[model samples]
Structures are given as structure tokens and as C-alpha cells.
Target: MDDRGGAPAPPEKISAVPVRHPGRWVAAAVLLVLAAMLVHSLLTNPNWKWAVVGQYLFAPRVLHGMLLTIELTALAMAIGIVGGVIVAVMRLSPNPIVSGIAWLYAWFFRGTPVLVQVIFWSFIAALYPYLSLGIPFGTEFVYFDSNKLVPIFVGVVLGFGLNEVAYMSEIVRAGILSVDRGQTEAAEALGMTRTKIMRRIILPQAMRVIIPPTGNETISMLKTTSLAAVVAVGELFTTVQLIYGSNYQQIPLLVVASLWYLVLTSVLSVFQYYIERHYARGTVPLRARGFRFGRAQGGLS
Candidate 1:
């Protein structure tokens, strides 16, 4: 049954695919209700004291403590990252003893609470009373005062770095394991040594997996430094506590500390997003060119 010059057409058929439910209206209603509640709360709250918050915002001690917090976070993260890589490599070593040692380190540090470790390091003198340094088979060459060993900075770094190493070791191990086995085999087939294979081929690919979790850990570590307040380290929160204790403006002073933490975390999150995008360049789908807001138009008339 050709109408003009074409051959007979196939029979028409109906499609069987199910239509997806559109939930935009439901979502919009929920969002509107939330906005209304937030606006009402802001209007009704009695403690919206901007003047009090502004009064101590730039106090010298507060600024100094903020700087100290940044310093502690940087130092601890640096040591943790370096030591974590070493422990991760050792855990994956061919030697049984090395692997066992790394395993034990990760297990113990991760199992214990970080606050307990901080207190222990802060009060190490109570147990040992002195520190001796020398070769195992030789006489002690140097003796240090135990009282000087557990300074505020030393205690914070030791506690944070050791705890971070345990967590980062697991992150690194997972990153290394995520590389395909065939990649190693291919590198071997090309006459690359184990070290070269790991450095050039495996690690590059593993970075994709490593960066995201590492960023999250970095943010967590920044916040965890607040725990040092318990040991009187004079970081941001401790400084806030001192101020509030003396001045009795607890809410505003505490709010300043909270705002600083919020700002730092927000900045870290932005960097994390950029780092993720850089590593994810080739693995994920790219946004289509000129595809604005779910519309597609480039067809000819």
C-alpha cells in the first residue's frame, strides 16, 4: 500500500514506557514553608544583638588565638600527611614485620579517643618524669627535662598528628587499592620497576579517589583542633572561653568564635570543590555547550 512512490509502511505501535512523576510542586511548597518559618524566627528572636558581637570582634587576644588555631591546623596537617603516606606504604610492604608494625599503629591510634591522647601527651611527665635519648646499645647522650616536653604546641601537634595519621592511612590505602590491577600489569610488561609503576602510573590514577576524602579529613581536622581548648592551648575556642569567663558576654563572644570556624570551613569547602573538579576532569560527563537550564536547541529549520 504505497501512497505515492514509497514501499508499504510498517504498522503503527504504542510505546509502553512509564512516565516519571514530577515532584517540583511538592518541593516548592516545602521550601516556601521553611522560608516563612526562618523569616518569622529572625523577626521574633530577642538575642539578635549585633552591637555586642561587634564590640569584641577585633580584640587582640581573639586575633592572636585565631592565628594560633590556623598555625596548629597547618602544622598538624603537614605532619599527618607525611607520616600517613609512610605508614600507608609500610602497611602495603612486602615485609611482614613492617606491615604488622604499621597495622598496629593504625589500630591503636584509631581505636583510642583523641582527647585522651592529648591529655596523656600534655601530662607525660607524670609517668616518665624524664626523657633520655641515645642509641639502644649505648649510654644516654642527652637528657631533657620532662616538664619542658609537654608544652601546649607540642601537646596539640602530637595529639592531632598521631590521630590524623591513623585516619589518613586508611584513606591512602583505599586510594592505592582503587587503581586497576591491569594498570600495574601493563606497567610491568613495559619493563617498569615497581617503584616507577607506582609513582607514574598508579598514583596519578589514585589521586582521583584520594583528593576528595583527604579534603573532607582536612576540614574535620581543622574543627577537631578545638579539642585543644581542654588542654588550655589558647586557640580560638579557649580564648573565647577566657573572654566570656571574665566579661560575662558569653553568647556574643562564643558567636565570634563560631563565625570564625564557619568562615574557615566555608573557604576550605570552596577549595575542595575546585580540587575535585580538577581531578574529575576526564572521568565525568561535561556540561553540554550552550545547554541552558535543561533546554536543547541547535536543530536546523
Candidate 2:
């Protein structure tokens, strides 16, 4: 009811306008120009030798080398994951000696360059020509020649695996530490053993933190296996080197290796995405959790 005994007049309409971002337009134009230039250079440069890349991309020897690379990656990561978990638990041990030894292992492996470690393992026979298994300081029951025991492939795997163990230990330790102390105490209150608490309560919750870095390490291991080329381990890079060494088609062969690595890493990345999504259930909205890989609902396309 209005004071004049009539309905009040409707409020006047107000208009609104969207904001403009001129800087975004400028940035987009610059990026487009750079991309066009790069594409033109790649297409016009006669030296890329795309035909040779195509020719040797699926060659028998190349495929064999790729298979070896995959094997090395899988084995190394398996060793790293298992060894890392053990070392991580050792690092958290109450005994000073155990913790100190674990710390020293991580320090030594992480402080040195991986290439140096690989080379050292490759030539370790020079340090100790024989290895024995028996009592620590008593009669030996079995002996093995170092040269036979640690071949180039085994040496390379040990190098990659041990070095990765150091890195993954720290990663696992961080994940374990990320879990709340209250949870462990609560588990203790419920009469759970320490091992049970860790296995059933802490680790499951900690996996969300552990998984992303572990996935990254796996992908990194895929690329780092190329280092085996230095020791003539016949991996992808080594195979490519042998091919290009004879034909002098170094650039194309390298491009082939790079393409294969990109493809493998891309596949690993997709797996990582799904693994992260699985562990992220109940914490984040599904649509906003990771890359959608689908139609955009709104915002920047």
C-alpha cells in the first residue's frame, strides 16, 4: 500500500555490461604469431628429415630397444617403490642407528649425480672383482664374479633403481608425515598395533599425497632410462645412436626417440590422471578435480 492509496511505482531498470580484457587479446595475438612462425620453420627446414624419422620409427631394432627401455623402467620403478617404502619406515624408526643408516643412504644416493652412479656401477668390478655370500666375517659359502653378476643391463638398472629409491623414500616420508598425528593416536586408542595403524589407517590416507609424485617419478624414469646409452645397454637412445652413427642421420633418429618418449609419457600422464581422480573421490568435485577432456561448460575455451 502506497501513501497515496495506490501501488508504488516500479523501480527503474539498471543496465549492466561485461568487462573487457584488451591485454588478453594482445597476448593471444602474440602467441598465434609465434606458433605460426615455428610451424613454418619446421615445415620448410630441409634438415629435419621427417622421412627418415618415419622410416626408422617402427624398425625391428628400434622396437626391440623400446621394449628393453620399457622393461628397465618397470623393473627400476618396482625396485624403487619397494625399497623406498622400507627405507622410509626405517628412517622413521625410533632406533638412532636405523634412522641414521637410512638417512645416509638417501644422502649419498641423492647427493651424487645419477650419471656418475651409473658409470660407477658399470665399472664396479674394478673395485671388487668378486662378491661372496656367507657369514659377514666368517667362512664364505658362495662366491660370484662381479663382472658376471653385474652386467651392463643389471648395473644400469641398479643405478636407476637405487637412485630412485632415495628420491622415493623422501616422497613416501612426506606422505606419511602428511597424515594427522591424531589419527595414529586414535588408532592406538582403539588398540591397533603400530603396523596395523600404518597399513590400515595412515598409508591409505597418505596415498593421495604419495601417488602424484610417484607417477611423476615413473614418467621421469621412462626418460632417464636413456642414460643407459652411455654404457651401451642397447636401450632406445643407444639403438638410435648405433643407427645414426653409421648413417649420419643423427637428428632424425633423435626425433624418433623424442616422439616415442612423448607418446609413452602421454600415456603415463593419462593413467596418472585417472589414478589421482580415483584417490580424490569425496574430496573434490569431479568436474573441477582435473582436466575434463570434454566440452567446456563456460569460461575460457
Candidate 3:
């Protein structure tokens, strides 16, 4: 109100103006130029041998190699996930001996490079020439040649699978720990056994945390299968190497392998996105629950 008591002066209008940063425009322009230059280089470079890449992309040998790679990934991950859950449970066991054993297993496997494990397994026959199943040292039973019992592919799977078990166990343990302690208490109050509580009550809820990283591990395993090539496993990278070795088209063959890996990883990523969204239901905000690679909405903060 005015001191004159006639009428209050109208409120002053705010002439708000937005601040701008010209540097952002310059940075964006520079990035666009760099991106265009990269694209031009990829298209114009004859040494890339895009035409050769196309020729072998779907060749019979390449396709076979791709199938083998997929099989190895699936088999290894299957072993990993199942063994992981068991080890995770053991790791969290109330018994000190059990938990200690589990910890030792993880320590040994995770402590070593996967490549070393692969090489060791491939040459395991050198150390143990025969694998025997019997009643310890007291009684002898049938024995099989180590090389026959553990084929090259089998050895590779064992290496990848055992190493993965160590990692997946940690992932599972973290997920299990993420579940509220109150939930376990409530289940126990209901007279549920530990195993029952884990299987029915805890694990289902922990899956929300478990799935995302598991998917990432699966994708990583796909690439790690390339390490199997050292033992002459006919997986994708091995097959590519064999082809390049014979034809001397190393770069082109390498490109083909990279393309397949990219495609497989992309597919896995999409699956991971959907699985994450599934788990995120009723948890994440509607608009924010999207593909991991999705751009953020709204203006710059």
C-alpha cells in the first residue's frame, strides 16, 4: 500500500533475461567437424577393405565360427550363473569353514588372469596324465587320458566358467546384501528355513540387483571367448585368425570379427536394457526408466 493511502503502486515487472555461453556453440561446432572428418576417413580409407569385410562377413566358415562363439558363451555363462549362486550362498554361510572355502575359491580364481587359467587348463595333461575316479588312494577305478577327458573346447569352457564363477559370486553376494535385513528377519519370523528363505523370499527380490551386472558379464564373456583361440578352439576369433593366416587378409578378417562382436554386444545391450526396465518397474520414475544409452531429457542445467 502507498503511504498516500490512495492505491498501492503496481508491482515492478521483472525483465528476466537468460544467460548464454558462446563457448558451448564453439565446442559443439568443433565436435561436429571432428565427427564429419572421422566419417570421411572411414569411408575413404581403402586399406580398411570394407569390400573384403563384406565378402567374409557371412561366409560359411565365419558363420560357423560365430555359432561356436555363441555356444561357448552360453555354456560358460550357464555354468557361471548356476555355480555363482551356489558359491554366493556358501560365501554368506553362517559356518566359518564354508565361507572360508568359498572365499578361497574366489580369491584363487579371481586373483589370476583368465588367460593364464585358459593356458593352464589347456596344458593340464602335462601335470596329470590320467584322471581317475575311485575311492581315494585305497581303491583304484577306471582312469581316462587327461587329454581325452578334457578336450580343448572343454578346457576353455572350464577356464572361462571357473573364472566367471568367482566374479559372478561377488555380483550375487552384493545383490543379496542389497536386500534389506528386515526382510530376512521377517522371513525367519515366519519360521522359514534359511534355504527356503533364500530361494523363495530373498533371491527373487535380490534379482533386481543381480540382473544388470549379470548381463554385462554375459556380454564380456562373449568377447573373452576369443581367448580360447590360443588353444585352437574354432570360435569366431580363432576362425578369423585361421582365415587371415592363410589368405594374409589380416585387417579385413579382423574387421569382420569386430563387426560380429559389435553386433552381438549391441543385441545383448538391448536385452540388458529391457531386463533392467523390468526390474525397475515400480521403483524408477516413469520417464527416467529408459535404455542405458538414451539421452537425457530437458534443457542443460
Location of the lowest summed lDDT over 10 successive residues in candidate 2: 292-301
lDDT of 3 by residue, 132-207 (tens): 8889767768889999999788899999999999999999999999999999999999999998999998898898
- lDDT tens per residue, model 2, 1-301: 5689898878879887889999999999999999999999889999999999999999999999999999999999998999999999999999999999999999999999999999999888999899999998899999999999998789999999999999999999999999999999999999999999989999999899999999999999999999998999999999999999999999999999999999989999999999988887877865575535544746433
Worst 10 residues of 3 by lDDT: 292-301
What lDDT does candidate 2 reach at residue 253? Answer: 98
Q: What is the lDDT of residue 291 in candidate 2?
A: 39
Model 3 root-mean-square deviation: 5.2
Candidate 1 Cα misplacement greater than 4 A, ranges: 1-27, 189-191, 288-301
Q: What global local distance difference test value does model 3 have?
A: 0.93
Which of the two candidates, 1 or 3, achieves a greater TM-score against the reference? 3
Estimate, for each residue in 1-301, the C-alpha lDDT of model 1 and write its tens digit. 6779698888789888977656977888999999999988756775756577787788899899888988888888887888887898889999999999999999999999999998888788888788999999789889888879667679778989888999888888898899999999999999999889878998788889889999998899888989999989999999999998998889889889988899889999999999988887778754422223433544421
Instruction: List the candidates' TM-scores in order.
Output: 0.84, 0.91, 0.91
On the 0 to 100 scale, the lDDT of residue 60 in model 1 is: 90
